[model samples]
Structure formats: C-alpha cells, structure tokens
Target: MKRYWKYIRPYLGAFILAPILMLTEVFGEILLPRLTSMIINNGVLERNEAYIVKMGIIMVLIAVIMAIGGIGAAYYSAKASISFSTDLRKDVFHKVQEFSFKNIDDFSTGSLVTRLTNDIQQIQNVVMLTLRMMFRAPGMLIGGLIMAYLMNRQLVSILLVVIPVLVILIAIILVVAFPRFEVMQKKIDRLNSGVQEALTNVRVIKSFVRETHEEEKFKTTNRDLKEGSLNAMKVVITAMPLMMLMMNITTIAVVWYGGNLIIAGRMPVGDLTAFTIYIVQILMSLMMLSMVFLQASRAMASLKRVKEVLDTEIDLTDEQASEKSAQIAAGKVEFKNVCFQYTKGTEDLVLDHINFTANPGETIGIIGATGSGKTSLVQLIPRLYDADEGEVLVDGINVKDYSIRNLREGVGMVLQKNVLFSGTIEENLRWGNETAGMDEIILMSESAQAHGFITSFKDGYDTDLGQGGSNVSGGQKQRLCIARTLLKKPKILILDDSTSAVDTATEARIRQSFTTTLKNTTKFIIAQRIGSVEYADKIIVLDEGKIAGIGTHQELMETCEAYQEIYYSQKDREKEAGA
Candidate 1:
C-alpha cells in the first residue's frame, strides 16, 4: 500500500476533499429527522400553519445543501480514483517491459494480464468507495445515535442489544469470506490461461479435430470459476438477509415500546417518530460499513498481486558497463571455456566448457542434432542469458563490459521462431532501423531474396501482414524476417536455422548475396543441412554439449567422425530420393 502512494499523491487534494464534502451530506441527513420531529410537535399537532411552513422551508434548504455536497463528493472521488488506476496500470506495464526472460518465467502471461486488467479495477472501486463512504457512514451512524439519545434516552436502549449482534455477524462473515475470495482469484487466473491457450492454438486444435476435447477442457475451468464465485458470494448473500431481519426486528421493538410510552403520557409522539428514524439511520450505516469492509478485503488480495510484479528484481542489468569499453566496429567473437545452464544451481550443463573463435569477416557454420544447445550457444553472443561460467567476448573485449544496448545493437539475430506483428511491411522493417529509407529497404529486401515476391503484392512495401505474418507462406515469412534483420546492418549477424523453410535454391542465392555484399560482416549460420554450410570459411560439429570438431567443411568431413556420420546420412537420403 505504501508503494502505491506515489500514484495517489498527485491527487491528494481530491482525495482529502471528497470525504469532507461527504460529511456535509451526513450532517444534513442527521439534522433532517430532528427538523421533522419539531415540525410534527410544534407545528402539526398545535395547528400552527406559520410554524409548519417555516420548518418545511428549513427541510428544503437542508435537502438542497445535501445534494450539492453529494455531487461535489462524487466528482472529486471519481477524478482521483480513475487517475490513480490509470497511473498504476501504466507503471505495471512498464515494469513488465523491464522484466528479464527469467523474471517473465516466474509469472505466467495469463496471470500478468489478469493482474493488470481485473485486479487494478478491483482496487480502483475500493479506493473510490473509501473516499465517498468510509467517513460518511460512520459519521451518520454516530450522529444519529446521539440525536436518538437526546430525543429519548430510554427508547435507544433497544439498539444496544441489536448493534452488538450485528457486529458479531459481520465479524463472522469476514472470517468465512476472506480465504474464499483469494481462492476465487486463483480460479480466475486458471480460466484466463485456458482461454488464452485455446485461442492461440486454434489452428492446431482444429486440424487435430479436437474441438470436443477443447470444449470439455474449457467447461472444466469455467465451472470451477463459477463455483468459486458462488461460494465467495454465499457469505454476502446469507449475511445481508440476516442483517435485514435483525434490523426489522429492532424496528418492531422500537415501535411497540415507544407507542406504549407515548400512550402512557411519558413520551411525546414526535420523540417516538424521530427515534424510529434514528434507528433506521444507525442500522443502515452498519450495513454500508459491512459492504465497504467486504470490498476492501477483496482489494487487499489484488494489491498484493500487483505489488508482486512491481517488486520483482530484474535478473539481467547493465550496471557494470563503462564509457571506455571498446565498440564492436568489426565483427569478431570468441567463447572461452564457456559453460551454461538455464536453471541456476543445477548440475546439468547445456553447453559444457565450449571454446571457439571467429575472426573479423569470417563465416562460421555450427551443426549438431536437436538439443545440442545450438540456440543457447548463440544467445550468449548478445547476452540474452549470461554464460554461467566463462567469458563471452565481442570485438576482443568481454561482452559484459559493453552496455547491453550497444552490444545488442552491433549484433543482429534472426531467432529460430520468426515473428512479424500486424502492420505494413515498411512499418515492421523500420523496427530494425528506424531511419531506413526506401532505397535502403529495397536493397536489404533484395539481399534477403524477399524483394521479388514482395513486389508481386499490389501494395508492395505498403502491404499489411496479419498477426505473426499468418498471411504469408512459411518461406515468405522467413525471408521477410531476414530482410528486417538486414536493415540493421550490424557488425555480426546470427541466423539460427532461419532458412530451413526456404528451398535449397533460394537459400543458395541468399548465401551468395551475403558473401558478395556483406563481405565485412561476420556471419554465424546454424543449420542441420550440410549443403547449407559447405562453402563456409569454417564448420563446427557439436556432439552433446561438447564441440566434437571445428575445421573447413572438407577437412571436417575427412577428419571428424561426427561430421562424417552426418554427411553420409544426408548423402544416403539424397540418393534414395533421387532413385
């Protein structure tokens, strides 16, 4: 709660003013009943027309004042609450943006989305109610009780018994309902997860003819959510009626006892009437108090969830970078006895004591079977995940020594899974180099072998792609991704199986363009096809977590057993296909 004060501080004036104005409305309500009692005794019963009209005018003035105060309270409360929630949501989103890969792994996407949207909304509602009702309810209750005692001290004794009973009931409701609200939030998270997954994988679900299975899975989560909500609400549903029953019973006792007092000449009819109104005021205020407490209990749970995101320590930072660190002007990279594990403190090593070097302007090919840590190895180049044990160097300086922004800017990586957001082709390309112009975009597209197909579209560069480039073929999407990376014109380019979707002929053309045009850029290509890396300056054969061999393609084919086995398998498959 203290952490969130910054958002509310800017609206402090509105926050303070709302409750103060609401108090005026409470005062008016308390005074109105007393004015009614005076009009009944001194004006109506005495048959004084002048007195009745004067008291009636006073009642009208009080009502007008209460209306104005209520409107002011509402306006200020709404302004403060809405602005606070907007700022809080923005901060939560910014914190999410700062999260490292490891940080994101700690919270699911669905859970984060729920916290941002629904949880913040819950807190907003509670804050608005706090400003408007938290003070007014208590003020009205106390004022009405005092006025009732002044009217007839004996008649108010009935409330002493009923108020204690209502307090006990509210306490019991809190004890039973708090834990259920927490569980209900978790159920909401599960429902959101199921919906998100089903939507994202709709194509796969349809192709597998699993609509019935998906429907059943959704039904299970939806039913759980419904049950949880019902259980949480059951406490409120039961408590409200019990409270009303107690209120009605207390009103009956007040009427029966007060009527006898009036008939016996011990009490005035006006005092009895005012005492009844005060009883209603006190009981209604207690009900409002219980409702506010219930809302606040749920909001406490939401506050904790939002605080979790804000407080998580980012795992990766660039605090150690200095001004004097060497720039990666020429693409040169090396790994020295590097060992890494995705899970910290785990004995399992994904890359074990691997050592390799690539000089400026050299093209290197890395080959291995699946799960040989191919993607993990290249990720270290840009410091996406730091190597657990050894140094990763760029431009002959430790990668850690350079600022993260500077280091990543010098290295362009086309990840294994290519993604394009919804936008014109030109807009997506600008993400790589914001300042890129028409000629530069056309040049990079041509180099990537994507220009020929792009021009076929009626809109050309202005063509809009669907989410994740769903409208394009796998090959076209891959080429467009490569073209986007080319716009960066980094010193080092890492293509991790980015060409696997394209045919061998188109792949050959792309590599040829890279060789001729990007002569000074160091390139690292990870591929399963031997033919893809046959013309490389060097080839690395990895077996398990170790580097089995590194040499020119012909040299590796002759001297490395792992390389020889892979080559023969590909040759045999090619011969069978040809036959």
Candidate 2:
C-alpha cells in the first residue's frame, strides 16, 4: 500500500472527488420515495391540486441534480483509474528492464507479458468500480432501511431473515473463487508461451513438416485455459442465481404482509407504496456491494504477480562494488582457476578450473568439440554470468568492480544467433553507437564485407529489415551483425562462430580488414573449422571443459595429442598439403 502511494498521489483529487459526487445520487434516490408518499397521502387525500403540482416540480429538480452527479462521478473515476494504470505499467516495465539474466529466468516471458497487460487492466476496472460504489451502496442501504422503518416497522422485519442468508452464501462463494482464479492465470501463461513459440518458429515447423503436431499441441494448451476459466466462473454463476432468488422472495413477502395491514386499517396505503420501493432499493444496494467484492478477488491475484517482479533481488548489480567507476582499458583478460555452473550448488561444472590469459592486442582463437564451454568462457568477461568459484579480471581489476554498462560497452560480441529489429539497416547498426556518423557506419560495414550487398539493394542502407532480419539471408545477416558490433570499435571484440554462414573468400577478406581497422583491438574467435583459427597468433584447444592445448597452430600439432587429432581430422590437413 505504501508502495502504491506514488501512483495514487498524483490522482488524489480525482479519487476523492468521485465518491463524494456519488453521494448526491444517493440523496436524490432516498428523497424521491419519501416525496412520492407526500404526493399520495397529503396531496391526494386532501384533494389539494396546488400541493401535488408543487411536489411534482420539486421531484423533477432532484432528478436533474442526480443526473449531473452521476455523470461527474463517472468522469472523475475514469480520470483516476486510467492515469493510475498508465503509471503502474510504466514502473513495472522499468523494473523488468533492470532484471539480470538470472532474474528474468525466474518468470516466463508470457507470464510477464500477461502481468503487464491483462493483470493491470483487471485492477484498473476494480479501481473505477470501487470509486463509484464505495460510499453510494452503503448510503443507499442505510437511507432505504431508515425510511422503510419509519413508514412501517413491522414490514421491515422481513429483511432480517433474507439479508443474513445472502451474506453467508456470498462469503462462501468468494473463498472458493480465489484459488480458482490463480489457477486460471497460470493456464493463461502456458497458452501464451505456446502461441509465441509456434509463431516464432513457423519456418522450422514447416521445413520439418510438423504443422499437425504443433496444431495439436496448441489445442491442448488452449483447451486447458478454457477449462480453467470455466472453473473460476462457476462461482459467479452460482452466486447470481442465489442472490436473485432471495431478493424476489423477500420482495413478495413484504408486499403480502403489508397488504394485510392496509386492509386492517393499521397502515396507510401511501406508506405501504413507499415501503415497497425502499425494500427494492435495499436489496439492490446489497447486490452492488457484493459485486465490488467479487471483482476484487481476481484483482488480488494480479497484484501479487505484479509485486513478484518488483520485489525480485537481482543477482547482478554494481551496488556493492568498491570501484563502481572503473572502466575496461587495454583489454587484457584473465580467468584464474574459474569454475561455473548454470545452477548454483550443482557439482556438474560447465567450465571446470578454467585458466587462461589474453594479452592486449592479441588474437586468441578458441576451438573445441560441441558443448566444450567455448561460449561460456567469453561470456564471463562481459560479466553476463559471474563465475561461481573464481575471479574474471579485466585490465588487472575484477570484472565485478566495473559497472555492468561500462564492462559490456568495452567488450563487443557478435553472438552466434544474429538478431535484428524491424527497422532500417542504419537503425540496427546505430544500436552499437547511437552517436556514430554515417561515414563511420559505412566504414565499419565495408570492413565487415557487408557494404557490397547493402549498396546493391535499391534502398541501400535505408532498406527496412523485417522482424529478426527475416528478409535477409543467413550469410548477409551474419555480416550485418558483424558490422553493427564493429561500429562500437571496442577495446575487446569477440566473434563467436559469427562467420560460419559466409563464404570462405568473404570470410578471409573480413579477417584481413580487421588487421588494419582494429590493429590494437584484442580479438577472440571461437570456431568449429580449424581453417578459421589456423593462422591465429595463439590457439587454445578445449576438450571436455579443460584446456588441452595452448599455443600457435604449428606448436599445437607437434606436442598436443588433442590438437593433433583435430588438425588431422579437418580438411585443413589437405590445405596444409599433407603436413
């Protein structure tokens, strides 16, 4: 509640004004029934035509006042609720942006999306309803009961039996409905995940001829969501019928009891007429109050889900760093007896006791079998994941000492999976350096060997890319990503199997450009083909998470058995002319 004050404070005037305005309607309704009794008893019985006309004119004025209050109340509630939701959604989005990779793993992408959109919408509806009915319903109930009791106390006693029964039933329904809503929300998360996965990989599903299998899988998730929603709604269905039954039964009982009194001459006909209207008003007020509670039950579940994201403790931050202002310089990287696992407390290590060093301006090539922790080793330098048991140092300082933004900006990585946004080619490249000039952008593209194809397009650099660069070929996408990273001109550059899709000739030219354009930049290239790293200044051969060899290509073939096996197995052995 204290946390929500920021969102509510700005709209406090509208929040307070909505309920106050609703009171005018409550006063108008209560006064209307009593005025009707005056018209019948005083004006009609005495045959005073003048009095009847005066009362009619007064009643019309009160009705006009009620309409104004009702509209004003609606305007203020809308003003408050919409503004509140907008600010709340912004804060939730900003909190998500602060999440570390590990923090994001705690919740599914679908769940976060649902929380940001659907959950907040539910709470907004409740806010509007609560403002309109918070005081209006209770005011109607008390006013109606008082007027009815004054008209004839005996007739009002019928409500004692009906109100308690309806209250008990509503309480029971609310308790049963809450857990069902929680389950329904979880079902929505699964359905969203299924839809996102299927659409994102539509091409793969088509190529593999798995459309039928995917359709069946989606149907199963959709059916589960349908069942869960129906299960929750069953409580609402049961509740409405019971409330209507009690209301009708009480209304009939009141009229029947009051009719006997009228015939016996114990109660006036005008008083009985007004009393019946009051009975209906009291029952309707009870219904409005019950509805408020019902919507609130669902909103409570959403509130908890939203709070979970805000309360998450990020595993990575510069909060405790002694040197938060430290920057990466010279690009000398070292891993001292590093040990890491994806899951903490697990004995199965991804990189076990890894030790390595790359001097400034050196070209370090890492080659190994699949799942040899090649990607894991380079990721540590950027502080993407902290090593579980050792230190990763950059420029003679612990990587943790530097802020995450500063550390990552200093090390540019062209990931194995190339991703591009739905924008012009120039826009995607600008993500590396937002202030880079057009001339600098073109120079990097030329170095990456992407300028040739880009210029051949009719729109050149202004050509719009589809989602994830879907309009481009795999080889072209790889070069664009390389060009984007090159625009940063970082002290340390990593190519993680980035050129695997390009032709050998183009790859060689791209490598050659690096010598002149980035002569002082430290480069780490992880490759599957030995030819890619054969001419490197230093080559590290990895076998099962441990470094098997560390030297130039020629030195590794002479001494390291693991390196000799890889060298003899590859087509590079042919290129070396039967070395």
TM-score on alpha carbons, each prediction = 0.95, 0.95
**Where does candidate 1 stray beyond 4 Å?**
323-327
Candidate 1 — which pairs collide?
none
Q: Give the RMSD in angstroms, all C-alphas superposed, for model 2.
A: 2.4
lDDT of 1 by residue, 337-365 (tens): 99998888988899999999999899999
What TM-score does prediction 2 earn? 0.95
Clashes of each: 0, 0
Model 1 TM-score is 0.95
lDDT of 2 at 271: 82
Model 2 stretches astray by more than 4 angstroms:
44-47, 572-579
The per-model lDDT (C-alpha) reads 0.90, 0.90
**Candidate 2 Cα deviation (angstroms), residue 172:** 0.8
